[model samples]
Structure formats: C-alpha cells, structure tokens
Target: MNRGKLNGVAGTTGALCAVVLLGNVMAPDAHAQNSVTLYGVVDAGVTYTSNAGGSNQYALTSGNMGANRWGLRGSEDLGGGLSTIFTLESGFTIANGKFGQNGTFFGRQAFVGLSGSWGAVTLGRQYASSSQFVGPLASGSSWAAPGMGYGTHPADLDNLNSTNRINNSIKFASANYNGLTFGGLYSLGGVAGDFSRNQIYSLAIGYTQGPVKLALGYLNVRNPNYSFWGNKANDSTTASNITSPVIAGYASANTQQVIAAGTSYAIGSATLGAVYSNVRFSGLGATPVAGLSSTAAAYRGSATFNNGELNAKYQVSPALLVGAAFDYMKGNGAGQGGVIYRQFNLGADYFLSKATDFYAVAVFQNASGVDSRGVRAVAAITGATPSTSSSQTVVTAGIRHLF
Candidate 1:
C-alpha cells in the first residue's frame, strides 16, 4: 500500500509540472524581443600648461579629448516598427577613479523613451539640441579627437563642445529624410510657483549630402546661472555658480541666448570646417551676486560675445590624421570694456586598432582688453586653470580605448 501511495504522488507531481511548463510556453509576452548592451571608453594623458595661475605645471589628466565613461543601452521591440529604448551613462575621472559631473552616478545621461520610423522622443537629463546637432562640425568634437576639450573656443563660451547638459529635459529627434534631420529640446525648471524659472529650450537642424554638411542651432535659457551652470537643486537667485572667469560677471543675468552655425566640406583626403556663434546675457542686475566677481556690479544691461572658428584636417594615411584650427572671440557691453581672445590648435592621431588610438594636441591662446571682472583680461582655457597673464599654452599626449 505504501508503494502504491508513492507512485500516485509521483504521478500527480509530474502532471502539475507539465501544466506549468505548458502555461509558460503559451504566454504571448514570453517571446518578446529585447537586448541590452554595455559600452565604455577609457582615456588618459599627461599634460603641460604654460602660465597656469602664474606657474607652469605638468600633470596627469583624464579626458584630454573625450570624456571617460561607461554606459548601458537597452532596447525592446514592441513590434510594428516601434521600439522602447533607454540609456544610462556614467562619467568618471580615471586618474583617481572618482565620479565626474559633481559625483552624480549617471551624470552623463539617463533617459528612456520610444522610437519609430518617424523619430524618437526621450525624457531625462540630456545634451541640448545645439550640442547634439552642430557640435560635430566644430573641430573640438571632430578630427581634433583625443584633445577636443583643449581645442574648444575660449572657456567653451558657445557650448559647441558640450560643456553642459540639461536636466529634466524632453527631447525630440526626427528620422533622417534624404540626408536632412532636425531636433529640439525643452527643460523644465521644476521650481515651485514659477513655470519659467530656470527653464531652457533649444532647436537644431542639420543636413549632410555626400561631402558637404551643414548645421544651425539656437538655445535660450531663463536664469542662466541657475539653469545651465548650477546643479539642478540650486535655486538661490542671490548666489552664483559661474566659475569660469571668462563670463563670471554675467552670473546675475536673467536670461541667456545663443545662436550658432557650422559647415564642413570634404575634398579627397582633406576636410575643411567653419563655425560661428553669438552669445548674449541680458537683463543684468545692478548688483553682483554674493561671492561672485565684483565686476557684476558694473553691469545693468546686456553682454554679448561673438565667436568664429575655422579648421582643417587631412588624412595622412589609413591610420594617421592631422588637423589645425584657429578661433577668435570678442566680448562687448555690460561694462566689459571690450575683450578679445585669439586661439590656435594643432593635433594628430594614430590608430593602433579599430578600438584604440594615440593622440597629441597643442593649444595657444592670447587675451586682451578688459574682462568681465573689470580688470585686465587673462587667458582662460577650457578644463584648465586660468592664466595669471594674457597668454597661455597647453600640450597633451594621450591614449584612448573603446569597448
């Protein structure tokens, strides 16, 4: 009798397992298609700067040309030409293995949305349309490569090099139509009782046909200091987060606007590029923000900066490239007493493999006239300390690997 009971129990268990397996096989969502990918870049270099804060210096730097980062990208096909997608990218400093972008874990980007044949719409922290669409035509983000930051226009005033990202943003990018594309972005301020406070909006259009490419972009920000420069939680109107001496005095401006255009043409083994940008800081306060440069008190109106750049690159061989660029910037109004910056950059890269490269770059800049601080202008390079004088030079050699 005991043996009979054991057999009956075994049969009952087998029947129940079969039913569960069949249920799983019949489920409609069980076969849904999805994929996830892990990607990253590592970069490091040694750098030398002439006239940094009154002293020449040499140091190990991270992200000489491009940022060090790792990320996860995922997509799920929902069928009918529509898909769900997401990305979570993190930035870090390789030198000390510290988180970048103010120690935020996913500081580079974190977004999710859907894509179809028409285009994509995403919501999260992301680059503005200007940087996404037009930045590539600038040498800082193009052939210059591994030392792009060092080649940026003075202080990256025009943001063509993507110095900042917008938080709480909604973005739209259209599908390419015969080599033409367009996009836009809007960032909510998230401030209580004020819809426009610290808000930002941007639009960009681009075209590429054969050897020719062109782009135009526009960006507008309210409470620029709090919106674009400070952390997302920053809400103090009487304080400032504008650290770059290049435009620190405009921290009290109520709004900021930018317009930029760029083009590139390829001829045989050579490519030529040009970019122009205009930046404006309007509705300046009569008094400077606390802990800010005293020069902010000198302005009660608007300040404007115009920047122009030209660059060229040549493919020396299948594995080597060389490039050069020239940039000029002028700032006026808002009691700046006129300021000017002229810069030059030279760079070269050699590919060791499809995923690794070595590069070298040199940049020089000179400044003249009065700056936003109401004092003699000083040379300032993006990602470097300000010079104590009117001139500065930086050189770097680096290696980059992608995975």
Candidate 2:
C-alpha cells in the first residue's frame, strides 16, 4: 500500500520462492516438538466508485474484502511453561504483484518475543496498543483482512484501521486473568541527542466474558509525521490506501493523541457493537521548505476529531453472513471549524468453503463544511479517491481464499 516504487522484478514467483525457502528452513522438530506454521490469504475484486477525482470509475483491486498476505509464525518451547515466538508477515497487491506497506518485505509485522504464564514481551516493529485492542471491536475490523475503510472513522484519525505501525518498540501483553487483560507499548525515536524527537507510548485494557467484549485504549505520539512509522517528513514513498483529503495535510503535527473505547454483545445469531474515539492533533505544521520557521511554520495550532460508530452482523445460515455499520465524525480546530463526515457500510459474504468465500460490499459517505485546503469538504472513502462533491459511493465484489 505504500507509494514506493514497485519492484517489478520481484513478482509473485519471488514471493512464492521465499515462502518455500522459509518453510523448509523452519521445518518442525519432531523430538523437540517445536513448531512453525506458514499461512496466507489472497483476495481480489472488481470495484466501482461514484466519484474519484471527478470521474466515475471501475477497476480491479486487491484487498477489498481482506488484505492479500502471507506470513510465517513459529514458536520454540523452552520448558517450564516458557516459549519463544516470532512472526513475519508481508502484504502485497495481486493486481500487479507489488509489495505493500512502503515496499517492506515484512511490512505487516515483524516481531520476536518471549511468553510465559505472566505475559508476553515482544520487540520489533509491531502494532500500536490502540491498534491491538481497540481496532478489533470496531466495525471496520469485523469484515476481515484489509478491513473496509468505510467503517473506519473519517481518515482513521484514531488508528482504528491499523494505518500505522511502530518501529523500535517494546510491547508487553499480559496473560488473560479471568477474562481480563491489559498491555502497553513504548517506541524509541532512535534519534540520539533528542530522546523525545519521535517517541510513542500507548496503553490498553480489555475484558471478555461470555458473549460480551469491551476495551479501552489510549495512544500518544510525538512528532507523528516522523514517529508513527519512522518515516521522514514529506516522504511520498510511505503512502498507503489512506490518502484522504481529510488528513493529507495535517500529518506534520508536534503531537497526536487518541483515546478510544468499544463494546460488543452477542444475542442470538446477531452481534451488535458500538465504538467511540477522540483524537487530538496539537501544533500541526507544514513541511519545511525554503527558509521555513522550523517545522511548525504554517501551523494550524491544534485540532480535534471525535467519532462514533454503531454496527451489527447476523449469521442467517452456515454459509452466509451479513453486516452493516454507520459512522460519524465531528472535527473542530483552529482551521477546521465545522467539518463533519457521515458514512454507511453494508456487506455480505457467502462461504464457498472453510477457507474461501465470495463477498460484496457497498459504502456511501457525505462530507460537510470546509477541509484543510479551504475547499468544500468532499466525501473521501478510505480506499478510494476523494469526490468533487459532498457525497460519494463505492461498491465491490470480491473473492478470498486462505492457505
């Protein structure tokens, strides 16, 4: 999903080769009982959007229903209820066999850690705490991989869609204690002489008893433009599917913070969920150009976004599942006084087999007030281009397979 140059030479064949090599190298040990697993999902679809850059368009896309990815997970038993674990995952677009996540081989995740009765401690690039605990309860994450953006709060300002990952991080996830669990994370900016340059910290707590689930999470970032993903300022290579006019120009912020909570309940064959999130961007700035006053020039001073979502899903049969979600976003700040966004998402999936399915989804969104560009706030779906008007619609049909 990154905007980096696609390595045309390393196509699907190369990926397959890498998978095979890794599997062979990590073959399970019979005596030790240590194990390694290889898994993946492939999804593709045809899509139509009511508006994209002032034109109605139809196209072939990857990850509409789920992200296309393959990964390796392994664990080594070290006796006494202790174990060492690791995971390496990568995402790619099947349409042109291009790597995703800014073209990193293990962009989705890359981590190694130790686990015991108490908890697990992991090190490496990984999901932020908010992304780990809160995102799961969001309607956007219910569908599957490459989660639908329509269910994400406008522009994903709250990190509910796993938009960014942290680097140089240490994470701790406590063992579930009678359906209660908690975790935390800290990422070092790795900038010597300035410990606070691009640091990040997060905490999350959750509980699940029976069919009820709840979670509360918080995340704070220093220099979001550089800390979120350890990317350089104004770097075009890190772009993903999240290019929305709603947040495109506000990335250069001195700090960003988010607090979110979610809960879900199951009744009969249906599950209902609700989520709320508040996000603040303080001291936003424009990229430094000629003779700019630090990186805070063009400062928007500060901004805030509040979002709410209600969603539900029903299982009508062994092979069919249907769901719907409604999301609302309210934005206010020095530059955005009345910006608001409303979105609706509906989807269905028909299971062809345990590891394969056919799916269809549709989304409609409307925007009101003005945007950062001082233009009318136009509808901008997560994975599609922004509309020239106040409303936009997107529909897609796709197939997915797992291995």
Candidate 3:
C-alpha cells in the first residue's frame, strides 16, 4: 500500500508540472510589449554682455542653446490602438547642479495620459497652446542656438518661446489630419472662493504640408500676476514675481490676453519665417490691493503690445546651419507712454554628430520711449538682466549634447 501511495504522489506531481509549463507557454509576454526610454540634453557656454546693470560682464552660462534636462518616457499598450503613456521631465542648471523652474523637481513637465488614433489627453503642469503651435515657427524657439530668447520679443510677453507654463492643467491634442492639427489647454485656479482667479485657457491650430507651415494661437489669463507669472502656490494679491521692467507695472492687471500667428516656407536649402503677436493687459489698477507698491499702483487703464518678427535660415551643409532674425515691439498704455524695442539676432550651428553640436549666437537690442514704470525704456533681453542703457548686446558660444 505504501509503494502504491508513493507512485500516486509522483504521478500527481508530474501532472502539476506539465500544467505549469503549458500555462507559461500559452501566456503573452507583457514585458516585451511595454517600453521605457531615458532621454536628456546638456548645454553649457561662455557669455559676454555689452551691458548689464551699467557694466559689461563675462560669465559662464548654462542652457544657452537648450535647457539642461533629463526625463523618462514610457508607454504600455492596452490594445485596440490605445496606449497608456507617461512622462516626467526635470530641468536643472548645469553650472551649479541646482534645480530649474523655482526648485521644483519635474518642473518642466510631468504628465500621464492615454493616446490612440484620435489623439491624446493629458493632465499636469503643461505648456500653453501658443508655445506648442506657434513657437516652432519663431527662430527664437527654433534654430537660434546658444539662447532660445536671443530672437524672441522683449520679455517674451507673448510667450512664443514658452517662458511660462500652466499648472493644474488639462490638455488635448488632436491627431494629424492630412498635416493639420489642433489642441487646447485649460488650467484650474484651485482658489477656494473664486473660480476665475488665477485661471488660464488657450487654443491653437497648425498646418504643415510640403515645405509650408502655418500656425495660430490664442491665450487668456485671469489675474496674470498670480496665474501666469507667479508660482502655483503663490496667493499674494498685491505682490508678484515679475521683475522685468517691461511689464512689471502692469502686474495688477485683471486680465492678460495674447494672440499670435506664424508661418514658414522652405526653399531648397533656405527657409524663411514670419510671426506676429499682440499682447494686452486689461483693467490695470482696477483693484487696489492693500500694501501695493507705489510703482504698481500708479498704473491705470489697459496696456497693449504689438510685435512682429521675420527670420531666415540656410543649411550650408548636412551638418552646418546659419540663421538671422529681426524683431520689433511696440507698447502703449494709459500713463505709461509709448515704448518701442528693436532686436537683431544671428547664429551659426555645426553638428558634430546626431547627438552633439557646437553653436555661436549674438543678439542686439535697443529700446526707446517711456516704459511701463513711467521711466526711460532700457534694453531687456528675455533671459538676461535689463541693461541700464537703451542698447545692449550679448554673445555666446556653447556646446549642446542630447541623449
């Protein structure tokens, strides 16, 4: 009887093993279907400024060509042309190993969403629709290396270079339809008592066919001081993070609006592009907050800025490119008088490989008339300190690597 029992046990064990092996053979390999990627860019350079705070200066700069960043992107197939996707991107200063974007980790972007043939929907901190659709056509955000701001409008008031990001936002991007695409974004104010306070919304449409591309975008912000300029947690009604003399005095404006359009055409080895934008700060000095500074309170009524830009680039070879751009900005408002800015940019880039490049860029800006602060306008490069004089120049040489 003991011998019979032993044989029976052995047979049962063999059956179980065979079942396990069969299950393993029949099951799908989930790991093979899912994928994750790591990516990053590093940029460093030496810069010379003709004037900064009344003096010429030389320094080492980080992110001259492109911001330093690292990120993880992943996707998992859920079948039926649907996939779950996520991204976490962080920006840092290569010069000192410090976090960028107000010390927020994953500050540049952090989002998760679903995508398929229709398009994608994501939620998190995100760029405005203008940055997505119109920015690419602008040389400042495109081929102008060593400094994305080199060719942008003064202070990037139109956000065509994506100087600001929206927090607590939801975005939708449509799939390409015969080279046409569109998208929108809305940000929640998260204010307990006011639904519109600190709120922002934007929309954009783009078309690309053959060698021609065009895009248009619109952005509206309620309480731009708190919504667009300040951090997400910032709640001060009387204070702001805006330091640019270009628009600092308009920080208390009740609403900010931007409309922009851009187009580009490629001909042989040469490309030409043009952009126009209008920015408005309405209801300035409408609400007088307690402890408001005299500088901010002196403003009244509305402020408007109209900007125009033209750029050209040529591909000298497979690995070398040269570019030039010109920009003009005009500002007007009650009590603030008239302001005008003219800027010029030139750049050259040489690619050592697919993932590495060396670049040199130069920018010059001149300002005139009265500024938002009711004082003489001074040259203010978007990424550099405001000049004490009406004219300023910046030159940079940099190296950038991508992985």
Clashing pairs in 3: 64-146, 65-146
Task: Write down the lDDT that model 3 would get.
Answer: 0.84
lDDT of each: 0.83, 0.79, 0.84
Tell me the tens digit of each residue's lDDT in model 2 across 95-193. Answer: 999887768778888999999999999999899887788898877776732444655677777887887888889999999999999999999988889
Q: Distance from true position, residue 29, model 2, in Å?
A: 11
* Reference-based TM-score of each model: 0.90, 0.88, 0.89
Better of 1 and 2 by TM-score: 1
RMSD of each: 10.2, 5.6, 11.2
- Cα lDDT tens digits for candidate 1, 107-144: 88999999999999999989989987888988877655
lDDT of 2: 0.79
Error of 1 at 3 (Å): 58
TM-score of decoy 1: 0.90
Residue pairs clashing in model 2 are: 1-100, 1-101, 66-145, 67-145, 67-146
Question: Who wins the lDDT comparison?
Answer: 3
